[model samples]
Target: MLEPRLRTMWLANAASGAAAVAVRTPRPVFADRTRTPRETVVASDLELVTVTDHSAVLTWTTRARNRAGRLRPVPADTEVRITSADSRGAPRTWFFEGLRTPYHYAEIRGLEPGRSYRFEAYSDGRRAVPARTLVTRRSGTPESTGVFTTATPPPGRLIRTIALANDLHYGEPASGLFAGLFEGVRHGTDEYPEFMLHALLEDLRLPDRAADHLVVAGDLTDSGTAEQALGVRAQLDDWGELGRDYFVCRGNHDVRPPDETDHWGNVFHPRDRLLEYFAGGLRIIGLDTTRVRGAGGTLAPAQLAQLGELLRGEPERPTLIFGHHPVTRHAAVSNPGGPGFVLDRANAAALHRLYASAPGVFLHHSGHTHRNRRSRPDSGIGVEFLEVGAVKEYPGGYTLIRIYEGGYMVNFWKTRSESARRWSTRTRSQYLGLHPDHALGSCADRNHVVLRDFSGLSG
Candidate 1:
């Protein structure tokens, strides 16, 4: 038999679970003159969210006040236990540390596909409320079973599709204008590098079953700072085996200031180093988009000529073009004007004409305005232009595009949690001086549009 105290605790926990269900329903809270012990001790805000393939990230906040009603941080050494239900129907436990900021986070990996798992966190060995998640399929060869649907089978013939992510501005101090633009943005507790690495890895791992190529559109570094570039490279090196066959293009942020050099001699040029690293199965074409004297991206006369030559001579094999700025008019955040730069309008026209003349170019990927948009600029051209979303701004997600025989499908996943969305709204209001809805709308526009029929060749 359990002691009286243990029995009371168990009853209180049961009542709390019942209350949680009640709260989730649409209802108003009634004030009770007397508060239950369970009400005061129970933690609030538990969320089980999936981050990417084969992993679910769990986060929760603890009750701030003790029974006495004095406010204090949760114990730093608090233990969080997460369990995954295995094939045998047994729970497997994974342990993590509970942070004192009243928050706890844990990531569970090595999960089996199409399975459901239940988990619970404990503070000082006391079981907390349970959370659950359903693990889904990761990247795999397209195969169908009688019980399930699958993508079309791989041609067994090699097909290449590139994964593109851009505008990660790591280590950049938040500016008031930029903050207002994002409004209530909040970042996870992990450092910028960790957040980026984790997110990028998740994105890359998605196509592991299908993609033969990967491309980073641009803005690899935030301020074009040497140290930041080195830090970026260090993170890239960690994926040692995956590092091979990835293409990189130059963004305005990747070049040196114009006063320093004509080319990127003064700065840490990731484009050159990336070329050396991905020698085969990857074709990286670098472009100088930054203006030395002012703001706005540009392609000089000589550079434009070179680009024309390259596109004209590109091999018949599958190819993906990566640059910082988009070639289409709809990609700009603000309208293009005099002294305002956007792919050098004339250069953009020339490139479109060139792609129209060349049938080999299948896709052109870019990331600058920090939005996701796909379009077929020329009906005659086989190329599809894809603008990837920014990691540092509104909607704050990346695009996962799966290339198959008939065509491709692009899915956009936003990084906004309830907490993150609130943060983003506040940040944008304070920094960009914009309303939350307006910012959200802009983000939505960028992420929602999809373009089909790339080649216009089939029809």
Candidate 2:
């Protein structure tokens, strides 16, 4: 009964409806869903610490929430990838399954010795930030390539020597206040630890020839807190493994007061807390100078006696002495009567006289007023008193001493990364405005020196 045109249109509409029902009934696009990428990701507590010959450890934390609601760990289905390359540009890749934790840690191993490696962390096929690590060479020999260059084997009996210096405060929070007191200046950047560590590792990873041993002079930590001490220890551990044998001496900042102890007792003491970790072939005389009230550093009567006996009794091997405080005039950063910065004058004189008489003492290293200088005592006993710059401060760098058959080379480098340099310039200007006199002494000397080819001891 319907019109022919109406019938035709109704039939067309029914056919279209049928097609729509067929499409929506089985494979509906709206039924299943895909998630959009997160708007914000917060990464924090990033640390590259606990380095070794074949391994390096990394730790970081992610915020509890993302824009949507909460941040969940990368699922087990997700893959975490790590890639590394040595200074020579050789690359290596490692893969791991993602872990579920606000705090994530990863240890990358199977690395070459004495090699510097750049690394990147990745999750879900997206790269995270980049970091760096170094592997130590095998004991008793230096790496032929990569981090170190070829060295001429000793013609005769070779005596291995390592340089020791300590107490360079690189990124001291109060650096601005003490800027004039310590001539060298640098800023406290967010990347302070990284920049300082890089400068030190570069020196330790120098090519040409690796050191037989390395010793930290003392006061590596600014404060006695576990966190500060741990930060310093991480760097030294990396260098130790890199340089073969590494040694440590205790400083005041390395000591923990008794009040801080819990049921387990004091966290760090002169011998047990600080020195025991890195004691190797390098003979370290851990002197407790922190006990002396209002004194730069002093060896207890018993300690001095013990040191004297050790110096006299030990074999003809080279010896290096490290303490937090300096013992003599040139070694002290501040003069006498000026806050008692160096060793008491009387004690310094006595120690110098003893050292002059002792042939076993090859080098004396110290760090308090963070600066770098070399002093030869009036005794003319050939012992070198080397003052190292701070790892945390401006002109921020470390002293790299290379010992060869006839003589040794001393090099000063700056921890002047793009970020660190900018901070240092600002800090130095501010400090110079405050205490100009504090900038006096060898610390003002910005040049790096190389003392080569003086025949005496072997190593």
Candidate 3:
């Protein structure tokens, strides 16, 4: 039997195979009806999403003719069988039943590296035309391939390079639903969140400059569903070891009403608690500022006390603070007023005062606003409040951080996947047709350099 960790990794890597495939022109398949040939099933747009050392994930659409003469997803029963192209082993099959949609997803694990495989689909036991072939990548290969590879694992002595991503909104079913409300944005993409995240992991895994540590600032989920949060954790696991190389926090979207329940009738509850970790000679803190009501947030008295203790524990330690909401209102006329732009301005001011007094605190990162904005406390606090754009929508990318003994530099990198970029462009209609470029403001919003004496930090 496979080890439990490896098994979980395999399952997580394959959970949303549907997102990896694109919808292609349907291919017609014949069926026998009363000794007469009739068009029955149509399947197309098969795509090989990610290929690991021992597994591959594929997705496509399978449609069947309806009484109205329309091609709809197969209902009652549908099945997919994936076998080694060379017939080197028994085929792995996936079975689906009950009312269904045109989308189909499947994963094949335990395959050798640098190998090839074939797959076919069936609707009620009838094979649906031509089979597709997939070629897995060789171990250690980094560039793109027909079957893409997973992100490379973190390397040794990894404190130098860190990556930051925020506002993922993982479970948001649609965008611009709050149109004419706060932001008056009315654009959203139909792409699955899992697919966007998968592409991000791959983009971050470039061979020459992979991040050693990745921190997701907040809004890991849109609906606070434990399942969605768990899915986010799984994708993060596929990128790096959790709790060691990665950390996360909570955002307003990750909080639901007291009596809220998911589609399955399960009551909504917070997924992640206050998170704190130490790595690479820095104290990384993830604050849960979500409140019970309203779009704004507040830090509980207990959390504030904890923050005070943490800061006082090592006043000289280099520290980084991250959360969902910003501590100060953005310096833009297009930006909203207090509590709307920053729900907890009072506490934010308090924290800034504390940070200004504590020279150790240098960076505060957040992502509530879907656009990029940067500010420092007007009171002359040295901390840099950097807000990143949403990962699942426009300005789709992450901030890459490189630390040195002297100073640090940050660069914003687009997800680099053609599919992700296209989706981002499609969502530019958000915020009342606000151009997508607004999410990615001038260069200053995405890039920065901090020159300070970090000799106090011991890596």
Evaluated at residue 73, the lDDT of candidate 3 is 51
Model 1 residue 349 distance off true place after TM-score fit, in angstroms: 0.9
Candidates ranked by TM-score, best first? 3, 1, 2
> What value of lDDT does candidate 2 attain over all alpha carbons?
0.46
TM-score of 1: 0.55
Q: What C-alpha lDDT values do all the predictions have?
A: 0.46, 0.46, 0.59
Model 3 misplaced stretches (Cα beyond 4 Å): 1-159, 179-189, 260-273, 331-334, 435-437
Off by over 4 Å in 2: 1-163, 168-171, 179-194, 206-212, 241-244, 262-286, 292-295, 332-339, 376-378, 433-459
258-326, model 2: which lDDT tens digit per residue? 556321113224442323222234354545555423435666666676666666776344556777676
What are the TM-scores, per candidate, against the unseen true structure?
0.55, 0.53, 0.61
Deviation of model 2 at 128, angstroms: 38
Task: Give candidate 2's error at residue 38 in angstroms.
Answer: 40
lDDT: worst 10-residue window of model 3: 134-143
